[model samples]
Target: MGALELLPPDTAAVLREAAARTAGVTGLVVNIAVGYGGRREIADAVKQLLRAEADKGKSIEEIIESLDVDQIADHLYTKGQPDPDLVIRTSGEQRIGGFLLWQSIHSEFYFCEAYWPDFRRVDFLRALRAYSERNRRYGT
Candidate 1:
């Protein structure tokens, strides 16, 4: 029910419309990334954090001394959501390509040979099974 992206004006308008339409139908929430990149996301979050703290009458030194991960997390686009447990990489890609960089610190990844268009339900099942078999250490 949310999106993470540096959206174009038109796209932002469309997203707003969609969100308004889906306001209260809340069994499952889906997040889609359009023009999204992790480094940019972090940069945006930092800008937002600075503005918010400044608005609260906090000086730069005060903000710096009190700054923590939670403050940054609060400004991230995916503010209220849990980090992903599994990320199935399609199209035979073996790297994360900076997807959800800050949030995916403890996620499990599955690389599939098929491209997104060619991916099927069985492949999804295989990815799920692979994830289920792993002993997630969450960085111990």
Candidate 2:
């Protein structure tokens, strides 16, 4: 996901390093969501779906009639990927601040006081531990 949605100043190098280190790990999928805003993601998804529909020559009324979560999801940037099970926010932030708006309906969160650069192995371990202890209802 390097330089995927970034403009300027955001570290593409860091994203490249991460992708290089984690490429084809053969385990759980990780989404960086870098240079992303939740509303922006949703808008992008919607636009993509609309474009596809238009290409198919579907009328506006027909497209609206058939629009659905799955339809929109298929056009999302993270299409075909499972939604996040856990989201960790660094830099002492307490909120997701619009990370995975549509996809993370039932996700768990782990907030850390350490900033992204300062976040360490121990901090990651603690976040994992926290996630392990949560009682997930998945919208019950």
Candidate 3:
């Protein structure tokens, strides 16, 4: 169970160096959002927007009208990554828990009774097969 928090300051730089040395990849955007809470992330984005408007001597209404999902997504750590096509939460947890809320607007979800460590490749394949068989009209 290797955690992302073990690295020190400038860990991104160190990781980039290590990746370059080992895998020959120089540019990478690693989002180590451990202990990341989605509600907090949204709150942080709002605070950032407020600070920006205050710095420019603007009003709250002006900022509110300009704010949209795209702006929020741009401010998010997972900005560039595509919204997951399917989100699988094992152990039968029937909640989104705010994971990629904006991005997962139309994403499919699959839940299983198996625990995280107990999940198998066959279970993953079954989820994919189920997704493939569904008529994903995206709420048409």
Which has the greatest lDDT? 1
Report the Cα RMSD per candidate: 3.9, 2.4, 5.5
Candidates by lDDT, descending order:
1, 2, 3
Q: Quote the lDDT for 111 in model 2.
A: 90
Candidate 3 global CA lDDT score = 0.70
Order of candidate numbers by TM-score, starting with the best: 2, 1, 3
| Candidate No. with top TM-score | 2
Estimate the lDDT of model 2.
0.85
Model 3, poorest ten-residue lDDT window? 25-34
Residue-wise lDDT of candidate 2 within 36-128, one digit each (tens)? 788988998999899999999999999999999999888777887889999889988888899888988999989999988788999999999
**TM-score per candidate, chains pooled:** 0.80, 0.87, 0.68
Better of 1 and 2 by lDDT: 1
- Per-residue lDDT of model 1, residues 1-140, tens digit only: 23424666787788888988998876655555666789999999999999999999999999999999999989988898888888878889899887888998999999999987698999989998999999999999
Alpha-carbon RMSD, candidate 3: 5.5
Model 1 TM-score?
0.80
* Residue 111, model 3: Cα distance from true site in angstroms: 0.5
Q: After superposition, how far is residue 66 of candidate 3 from its true place, in Å?
A: 2.0
